[model samples]
Target: MTLHIYNTLTREKEVFKPINPENVGMYVCGPTVYDFAHIGNARPVIVFDVLYRLLKTLYPKVTYVRNITDVDDKINAKARETGEDIRTITERTAAMFHQDMAALNAGNPDIEPRATEHIAEMIDMIERLIENGNAYEADGHVLFNVPSMPNYGALSRRNMDDMIAGARVEVASYKKDPADFVLWKPSDEDTPGWDSPWGRGRPGWHIECSAMSRKYLGDTFDIHGGGHDLVFPHHENEIAQSCCANKTDKYATYWMHNGHLMVEGEKMSKSLGNFFTVHELLEEVPGEALRFYMLSAQYRSPFDFTKEGVREAKATLDRFYTALRQHADIEADDVAAPDHFVAALKDDLNTPLAISILHELLSAFNKAPSPQTKGHLLACADILGILQQDVEGWFTQNTAADATEVDADQIMGMIEERKNAKANKDFATADKIRDDLDAMGIVLEDGPGGTTWKLK
Candidate 1:
């Protein structure tokens, strides 16, 4: 079955038809590089990564662009708080974001343009908006004329009146309407700014994506994705600026958004002390386990992250690995992924259902007697990016409950003794040692490479 995406703009699930059959271009809004990315920021990263993978399989070329917002107020504040240069702060935080996202198995985008680097493009787009009468310059600031874009509230499905009330537009005297959003704002000598037609100023938050995406992927791309929070004024303003500047009716064909993440069944907030950064969570849990837990639910549904939830996801992965280890000698065919699995994923990326299909495939593989069938099972697991680690390495590196106090030499010595006991036909002693280790949450695997262990 062909892929079907639920386009937020159309308010319906439509078949995904790329502008060019040979290539697909997708753009996702990246994080503002002021602080470490939290779990909430990771949802779209993983969600879009899966889409990128799927697209690569169907199309020969896919150019995925996710921008880095480096010149925002948050970055300026972070710089002031630390008494450091803005460039230093943004560079450090952006590097940390890359490390965190890599841990979650997210592939890098084809082009990662920074906002500061694309100032010229933003300025050019703003100029076109002003020339086309969709924007005006006032008091060294450029503001988009909201009323000029008749379909301003199409994507969010909000009326202009309600949007004006909810939107946080600056109440400058130059603005003709309250709904008018800023395209460019004046920046001081200390702040980051570039020379523009109106004055020396920085581009506003919304225009960067429109300008950069157009420069990299053209005026209209296949898919534009971001968090649900950006659906309102941010994306709405993008639609206005891009369509007006380019003289087109549509900016992007499909608009995708992932739902918010919560912690312990409540909204994750700093005041509640529940906010978790990806770097902090990786200390206690494997990144694969986190990715698995995130995909356990639909992308459009709220995800509640808890300690118990992560543990459960890890346990589930252990089961799949256990079955594969039992039939390690199996050599299966390199077949394509099952049609059922593809169908589920193609339906707006229904990963929960696709994962269920994986479980079924695992069960079938466990029941198969031939070594070749087992190999095909493993191949399928590899496509999902699970069961790729050395089975022995998974247990040894991941199983330690209190890794701080454990000595590596001591654990290896125990495993050596267990091997000697089994070789000497001392079944009773070997069983006792295995049971003792199991009680400590250590699992032993006896294989051709001798005995290996992992934390339970």
Candidate 2:
């Protein structure tokens, strides 16, 4: 099947033709570690992760690069507010990011570069941009010359007048134009700094990505992805710096962006009391359910997150798990996924359509409990990064926090006792144990494999 992607650059859905078919490269902008990653931050992580998984399956070699912005002003401010060392704050926050993404079943990128490690590259690119007459250094601050690139607003399609009128970006006293963005800025003695020709300063947020992407994926790569919000000055500035410095019109061949996330038909905000972190949501629903919920909508559509939505997602997964439970004795066929499932994903990563295919596969598995159907069902789940855990484990997992409640082990022990009673022809005792378990909120299913239980 021919792969297709909706390019944010051209504003159209086009067939995906990689620059180098032998070596496909994709770069996704990662989190700037200052605090726990909220639900909005998770959208692109999960979206591009599915894309990464798809690329790996189709290509012989794929390099996925995601950079960590560990050297940001937010990290410095967080250190000051918490009275913790800067390194301590960034290190802890980055580790938590990895943990949270892992819980959501996101695989590690092939190249996970950090901004602090790529400072030299950033400095080199800044110098190149200066030589190419695309940037200027003023007042110990280096800024990209927006007017230098005639196609500055091409990606976002905004004229200079429109940007100046609608833009809320700060205009510094030293900037030649209000549209010019920072490449490097002076760092206070208390903050992290790297000595450069411009004096003690740190690279700007835009330059960090430009340098890192060039270092890992060459001056130009196949695909660049991130949240839809980064299309403005962040990605636009990266395009200017990288293309100007590298002497190329095209930096990344394809631009893919996931849409924004909302909560219950409104934008999520801490002040609005609708704010939620991925870590907090994981406490209520399994990470698998959250991942599934995010994929229910296409990548480019605004997703309205609701508690009822997550619960429904969890219940839907329960249906898939129950199908597998009924056929536990038959191992999942280790084979390729159905063609229709792959086709849906290839068509601009239409996950809602892909998930619909998944349900069809589930129905097929329910109709015929054979290895081929089971394998197709599971192989498709692998592409979506769901239903990876054991079927028995899915039913046994206890997320409800009530110390007084019976655990999975005790419930299983009761099942085993009932099995023994039935074997000894003590039908009355076996029925009583089943009744007791039901009263404790455990629903038992007797299948070809054995008795499995799920909480009501």
Candidate 3:
């Protein structure tokens, strides 16, 4: 199948033909790792994750590289605020990021490089830029000469004049042009620093991705992806530095960017009091529901995340799980994802259309009489990364019980009574008990061993 992606550079959907069909390389800019990742931050993580999965399916081998920005100004600020060591903050936050993304079922990348670990590589790239007259040292800093790369604004489609007007360019005496961005800047005694040709300094934000991507994925890769916010100065600088340093016409064959996310109808911001961390939201909603809600919209469209929207997504997943539970005897066969679903995903990762196809499959599975129908439903769901939980487990894991309120014996007695009602063909009574439990937002699932419950 030919996969097509919307190349941000061209501003059009183009067929994705990898440079080397045998091996595909993809690079995505990762988080700064100073704090918990918000739902907005998760958009790119999950969006690119789907593309990574799709690419692996289509190619013989796919190397997906996502970097960890452990060294940043943000890290410094966080350290000062918490009175903790910078490394400790970065380590803890990175671990939390891994846990949160994993909970959303986003698979790990093949190569996860850290910026601090690749300082040598970044310095080497900077040296090459300096040798090529694309960079210069001034005020103990190395800055990329934006004018050296004529295609600096191609990805963002902003002219240099307009870019300079919009950007809050530091009127540094050292910079040759207002558009020139820092490749490496000197770090003070307190900040993180590493020995470089330009003295003790740290890499600029854009250089980390350029250097890490080159070190792992080579000078030119198949795809580079990130949030839309990164397109302007971050990605544009990456394009200029990589292309200029490596003497390559193309840095990445395709550039994919996911849109911004909003809370309710407004932009999510700290001042708005809607800035939600993934960790905090997980306390209220299951991570699977969050993932489902994210995939409900097309990746490029700005998503409005509302409490009601998440509740609706949870209800949708519950319906799917309920169907699977009812047909536990139905054995699904292992098969490739259906053609229509794959087609939708291949077309620039159209998750909205892909999800619609899944619903259609669900409907067909519900109406079909063949025992194989359940297997087919499951096979389709596997591609979408849902319905992997034990059908009984989903219903039993999150039930209504305050830790200090309920005794083990009481719960056991209720289960026993519910089981007796089911055995005596007293489904009315059995359902009533289930309804009573559900009123507390609890779900029950019966199995060969016994009945289990979970909070809804």
Candidate 4:
């Protein structure tokens, strides 16, 4: 079946039709390099990465552009709070974001433009908005004229009053209307700035995406995606500025948004001690396990992340990896995934449904291990971006419970002693050795190949 995506702008699932059949363009809003990327920030990265992979299979070329906002108020505040150079802070945080995302197996976008690098493009777009009478300069700031665009809130479907009430609308006397948002603002000597038509200033948060997306993906693109939280002032303003500046009715053909993520049945907050940075979580859990847990729920549903849920995901992967290891000797044929499996993903990226199908495939493979079955299992897992690691490595890797160092040699020596005791018919010594290892949180699995041990 062809792909069907639930377009947030239309509020309906529509069959995806590419503007250019040979190539597809997609733009996703990336992170602002102020601090380590939180777990909440990872949902869209994984969600869109799935779409990117699926698109690659369907189309010949897909240009995925995810921008990095290196010059934001948060970054500025971080620099001030720590008394570090702004460049130093942004570069360091952006590097960490890349490192953390790579650990999650998220392939880098085809084009990752930084906001600071595209300052000239932002200025050019703001200039066009002003020339087109959709923006105006006031008190050294350039602000988008919300009233100029008749359908300013079309994408968000929120009225002017509701938008103002919902968003943290800045109230400045220079603004013509309360809904009017800044396109550019003057930066002081201490702040990062670039020369522009207005003054030496930095681009506003919303305009940075618009300018960067347009430069890389043209005035319009096939798909634009981000978290659902950005539907408000951020995306709405983008639609207004982009359509007005480019003189187009549509900025992007399709808009996809992943749902909000919560941690342990509540909003993730530092004060509550549930806010997790991907960096710190990597210290305890495997990144692939985190990715699998994130995909356990459908992309558009509110996700409640729990430590137990991560453990469950890891256990599930362990099962799949065990099956793969059992059939490691088979020379499998390269094959396409089952039609039903691919169909599940095409239906609005129903990852939970797709994953359930994966379990069936695993069961089928276990019941009858063959070249085609193993190949089919691997193909389906590839679409979900899992099961690519070394099977032996997966079983040997340390889980959250086994984050502390353990003496593998000592454990193996005890296992050898247990084997000798079993061979010599000393049942008491064998049981004692098993009990001692179990007390140490070591689980033993016996197969025809021999005894294997892993942390419980």
The TM-score values for the models, in the order shown, are 0.93, 0.95, 0.93, 0.96
Question: For candidate 3, lDDT tens digit of each residue in 40-142?
Answer: 9998988888887777778899999999999999899999998999999999999999999988888899999999999999999999999999999999999
> In candidate 1, what residue range of length 10 has the lowest lDDT sum?
398-407
Best by lDDT: 4
lDDT of 4 by residue, 1-456 (tens): 889999989899999999998989999999999899999999999999999998898899999999999989998899899999988988899899999998788989999999989988999999999899999999999999899999888888988899999887989999999989999999999989999988899999999999999998999899999999998978888999999999999999999999999999999999999999999988787789999999999999999999999989988998998888777899777999899998999999999999999999899899999999889988988888898788777766775643556688898999999999999999899999999988877888888877888776
How many collisions between residues are there in candidate 1? 4
Judge candidate 3 at residue 262 and give its lDDT.
Answer: 92
Q: What's each prediction's clash count?
A: 4, 0, 8, 0
Question: Which ranking of candidates, highest TM-score first?
Answer: 4, 2, 1, 3
Worst 10 residues of 3 by lDDT: 399-408
Residue pairs in collision within model 3: 332-375, 396-453, 396-454, 397-454, 398-454, 398-455, 399-454, 399-455
Instruction: State, as a TM-score between 0 and 1, how close model 3 is to the true structure.
Output: 0.93
How do the residues 133-201 of candidate 1 rate in per-residue lDDT, one tens digit apiece? Answer: 999988888999989999889988888778987786557788888888888999998888888888888
- Superposed by TM-score, candidate 1 places the C-alpha of residue 190 at a distance from the truth, in angstroms, of 1.9
Clashing pairs in 1: 332-375, 332-376, 395-454, 399-455
